[model samples]
Target: MSSSSPHLWSPVRWAENGSVRLAFDQLTEQRDGEPLLLATGLGVNRLWVPDGLCRMLAAQGFAVARYDQRDGGESTHLPPTTTRNPITALFAKRGEAYTAEDMADDAAAVMDALEWHSAHLLGISLGGAVAQRVALRHPDRVRTLTSMAAVPGDATGLRTMRYIRLRTLAKFARLKFPDTPEGAVAAGIAASRLLASPNRPLDEQAVREAAERNVDSGVHDQQAQSRQIGAQWHGPPISAIARPTLVLHGEDDPLIKPGAGKAIASRVRGARLVLLPGVGHELPERAWHAVTTEIREHATSAHHPPAPPAR
Candidate 1:
């Protein structure tokens, strides 16, 4: 594949796990960089992880790689079912597709493809929830964990609802965009606007080109989103996430409240929580420095333990 502006991604690669094929790509070369895998929100492709953010992480000695989860982007799309409403499927008694454990394995499969024995994990929104499950299910595969704008993996149904803002949830139903490529960009911007911090002006240009390239992202496909969210997590709870964990949430997040981050930080022993003032579900340019710095410091601390106290 050819290179593009803002997003300096390498050639797209395919990683397969049984019937599912995941699409992934790496940032610029960093031979000695630490392995960092990023995961995005519901029904989003790897492109959802902002190019600037990935570049900054890469510049900070992290070999970054992002992939599309099953049923999103260029990855495998499972068969549709009667489940259409994401909210209903979220609290359903049984999964209509696969278990959350399967999604966790999907992340591992990508790591295997990249030849990484283990890597640091960063996830946002629904991706953050998946990352938590990944940490719980494959503890040995995760070195450090960062979950942003997400609820606890173990929380389901009413428990999960406690952290969600219903007013913002209702807004998703009202968003309508055209069926063209331009429409895709518009929809992406609209969603970002909904999740962006009101304190900062929404920069549509920041994500327009990337969204254009990732037009195939099934963001509007509620059926696929239902299957993804409906997949139940029967694995260990967040308490079992023993990796060095960092929980971050936007103080002004319109969709998932900051309490979700608090829940994760509280349940995971020694987890550090950072609440970003005027930040929201979407990572705005203003937050780039703070977010990357926190991750860099957290990862560094994880790898290099504090010197033993001198007597």
Candidate 2:
């Protein structure tokens, strides 16, 4: 096992109920520093994220933690009633339900379990939406926020004409992922080619290994994916959020257009928006260096804001 892997952070029970048990993994030596929670995107296996990225974030000097959101890979899966038909429960006032709010609570519950009064919040795609909700719902617990490649909410509509290239879609559709880890690794390589940056050649072997590791942890649940989409669909508007925020999005994201990012940055007062040219929905390996640098600077500067100008 690698020294900086979230595996070494060890799993701690984050929350539980009659249905599921959620947990978070630590990726650094100190849990007491400004805690940075890394929430994965929709339908993404928590382990699917490259270990090197997590390690680099931890090594950047924040106490890093990551976790499987409820019903995602390696997290407790819910019953068919909820996971399969999440839309029905969107407005239902009930316990043990999974909405975007509930998902944000799951992240906050992890924070609560850690006894962290507040921490840096960062997320990807759908997780980026979750980060916004976290700052909205549990504002006290979020010291700073970094939302990447996600829309604010339904308030900002995606353009009607946006669509992925058919060749790219065909490549993904043709990918036949096997049940075994080896085949999953191959599948990852295929998907990487489909979603990778147009500016660089895909790293076939590294993505394959990352895919295999994620497969070893667990397969992504289609039903859970249903719940995650429902949550994003019914999520609250975030225009009024007052947290110090960094909004990063690919200039050419076809799934959720760059306008969504612009809308979000416009909504959140003082949000810094960084447009990655020649990028897309996927956070390719090449983007990590710039992505992480912005996050590190954003979080660190939150601690040392400039003095008030002469009054």
Which candidate should be chosen as best, given TM-score against the real structure?
Answer: 1
Lowest-lDDT window of 10 residues in candidate 1? 1-10
Per-residue CA lDDT of candidate 2, range 232-270, in tens? 434456776778999999876645577768888988888
Which residue window of length 10 is worst by lDDT in model 2? 155-164
lDDT by residue (12-97, candidate 1, tens digit) is 89899889999988887574699999987888777777677777898888999989899888899999878887888878987888
Cα error of candidate 2 at position 176, Å: 6.8
Report residue 197 deviation for candidate 1 (angstroms): 0.9
Please give the TM-score that candidate 2 achieves against the real structure: 0.80
* TM-score per model over all chains: 0.93, 0.80
Candidate 1 residues lying further than 4 Å off, grouped into runs, are 1-7, 177-179, 204-217, 307-311
> In candidate 1, which residue pairs clash?
none
**Candidate 2 global CA lDDT score:** 0.67
